[model samples]
Target: MSDIIDIASKEVGYKASSGNKTKYSAWYGMNGAAWCHMFASWCANQADVSTSVVPKTASTTTGMQWFRDKGRFKTKGSYTPKRNDFVYFKSDGASHVGIVEYVSGSTLHTIEGNTSDAVKKRTYPLSYHTITGYGVVSDYITSSGDNSKGKNAKNNKGKEELNYLKKILDKNTDKKKKSKRKVKYKISKIRPGINLSVKVIVAHGTAKYKYQVQEGMKFSDERKGAPGKLTFTTFADNKRKITNGDAVAVIVNKRKFFYGFIFSFSPKTDGTLEVTAYDQLRYFKNKDTYISVNKTSTALLKKIAKDFKLKCGKLANTKYPVSRIDDNATLFDIVQNSLDETLIARGKIYTLYDDYGNLRLREPWKVNVLISGQTAESYDYKESIEDQVYNQIKLAYDNSKKGTQEVFVVKNSKSINQWGVLQYYDKVDSKKDIKLKLKSLLDIYCKSGKTLKFNNCFGDARVRAGCLVPVTIKIYDQKVSGYLLVDKVTHTFNNSQHLMDLELSGGDFDSSY
Candidate 1:
């Protein structure tokens, strides 16, 4: 036997002995239930085989279906037995695990956990059907030459004895056809990211088997004709009936433009055959750049060009041309006015300064606002805040009948405040409430909540305690406006660099004035 099979068997033995009810539970950190996947995972880990173990919650039927979909291995009822393979039996809303020992004709000898008490070896008849598909752990097999000596010799001797018994039980083969041996081939492995060189041994018959490798072709230029023709050939053909000391190869060329190799055999028969086709193309990171296009931004740019009768060039090829009358100047104007209203609603203070470096307030005094709150210091925290507060709010607003809510600037003659407005009362109230709703929403979107922080305020925006300066909160509305204010504020900005201190209060009113 190969090292991989020995390792797999040893792992199975260890797991079977470690509490039959919870065999291999340490792998998944679940100690209460019988986990067949955990058992498989543990065995694969020992065998040094890299494979993903689906969760125990996955139905036995689903796991069986996956094996069936592979269309490999033999089945006898519900129990398909193979060396180093996992056998799952339906239990109480879950499944049980077992390891194959040896096949006695149609009867399978297996080592199983929690079967008739603890881990034990038992012989199950082939008629005890319900056999899910078999799982082949590794393609490596022991050569007939290796088994001709030492401990393997004894095992072979035992196997020969068993084969004799099997032959005695079956009395139907004709003596004339006995000279024509049966050929069997078993697939080993397919090296990924390159052309496949499949290896298989012909067990009987005339050892030569024709192999063909085909490429999935697409017409590169249909206007002219097909690009090129493809040809396949067998690399090696070892004549004479194959036993243990023989090997055959089928080489496939993997060109950069080719998709994958499609392997086939001539005169397909019920003989054992191993074929592996490698996927030449892999998931390249740069390919994602081609798949991802900022469609919304592209559409918006096109719409702007059409509406204004303006000529727009490709972003990659040219710089944004500046106009005497700035087209984007209106956007800044809208943002400024909205910021003022938002500030007032949040009960915060802000000052608007014009382009000439002059305060727009009537008092013309540099007012200072002191903000007290914790600041978020990590990238993860900031990202979580944005995902919660901004992204969630935007998504909710977009899905609502009101379309997108306008973030307005609350402004009085003396002060400006920034606040996000929600048209309907569908959860969001305070920052804490918003964070909670965002967590749930993010979980729904990402299918996992590990990326978000549950409860943590970002930070206050003031440079020093009790120190306030002339500030203006720029809100993104349809237009910009200015307001002036003087106050002491305590607020946490989830994700902002310069504008953190400002709490929204019900008493503070939002007005354009």
Candidate 2:
């Protein structure tokens, strides 16, 4: 466990790289926004705090409300700010937040973001007028005591080395390779009897919004789609109107870009339509349903899809009994929860999307592309120990027939020695087949001792999220190459360049795995 202060101190001098956007924005899914609250959330996330302890948000008011709701908040003058607590204040009639560094006498020191557009330490008197309250985060703080002093010194050394390496790479312009591919994007409206394409202005989507892997790719409680917008012109007559709930498609470079549907559309005076679209799952979002079953998890899911007239594919055969489950949730809720356990146990994932009005559920596809200096414009590499790589997992499940809870444990002793015992727990039915499944999962994910994230920008319009791509890049004055599984991808198109921001994980090139 890492101390909260230690995690935050490492990023004290952080600043926005462009506009109001800092790398910390990625942590809260809000770029180009005031980031004081985001900085605090990022620190909590790095400390591995549960959502119940610290609800994730970028808005200052939302963060303060979460702390207050949890009874961890006290009025500013009512309590002295402690180390690792969140301090909320009103600046210019707007709320802002920061993480408390320490308290000395009546002076409260804090680490805040968006303060003069950079992260820096600031001090204030306990009775400052702008102060609102303090959120106690001491319960979530894990300490190494004086041992953290040594770790901080070692981290500073790593930063110095990284800075020196960056200088060397910046001077090596000869390594850059020129690309010959052209960039283009177009939006298409596909209905029962027509297909139309138009020039697109801008397109953007974040996996954190609607395509979240952990949340079963469903939109937020207050939203309906993965949240996407398109600006385009319709040259045809106003006969066929592209209205809400209409199935639409986006194409770039003569390829099927996204299979989605129109959420809302507005026509402009210049004969253009600003259409908002989401993934195909938006079509069945409001279908309320009920199920009371004593069936296998897979069987129950298939039955739900069939009753709803939905098409499902690539159903892997892993029979696990899920009995006496009664719920009044939607069809999506049932299907998503049925497979949630498998996802956590083995990293297995499934998606449901409409393929041109045909709803389909199946495992996502992988694309293997060899990205090098010639095909990529810019690339960056990041590795962090906070990713929580597990080499051992303990599974506990209730055996109603046996009247006891059975345990299944799997471990890699070599990994435990090298990286320590990173542990995980899962609730699964006690079956020999399920235990075998857990063992196979540990063997695959336990090989890597650290988490490596690769960010690459290239001109490939075919690259999409969930695709497996091989990367070969030189960083830290050394060549780091590996095949990474793409977690999220963003396609940015413009007149000068077509760029893709890809977040990739898994697979290590520096180790013997």
For every model shown, what is its TM-score relative to the native structure? 0.25, 0.41
lDDT of 1 by residue, 354-426 (tens): 1111112111232233111222222121112222122222212222445444331211221112223311113
Determine the backbone clash count of candidate 2.
0
The lDDT per prediction is: 0.30, 0.54
After superposition, which runs of candidate 1 have C-alpha atoms over 4 Å from their true positions?
A: 1-5, 8-23, 52-59, 77-81, 90-95, 138-513
Model 2 agreement with the true structure over 154-197: per-residue lDDT tens digits:
12212222232343333232223312222222312112112222
Q: Which candidate ranks first by TM-score, i.e. highest?
A: 2
Candidate 1 lDDT for residue 435: 38
Model 1 weakest 10-residue run by lDDT: 282-291
The CA lDDT at 108 in model 1 is 61
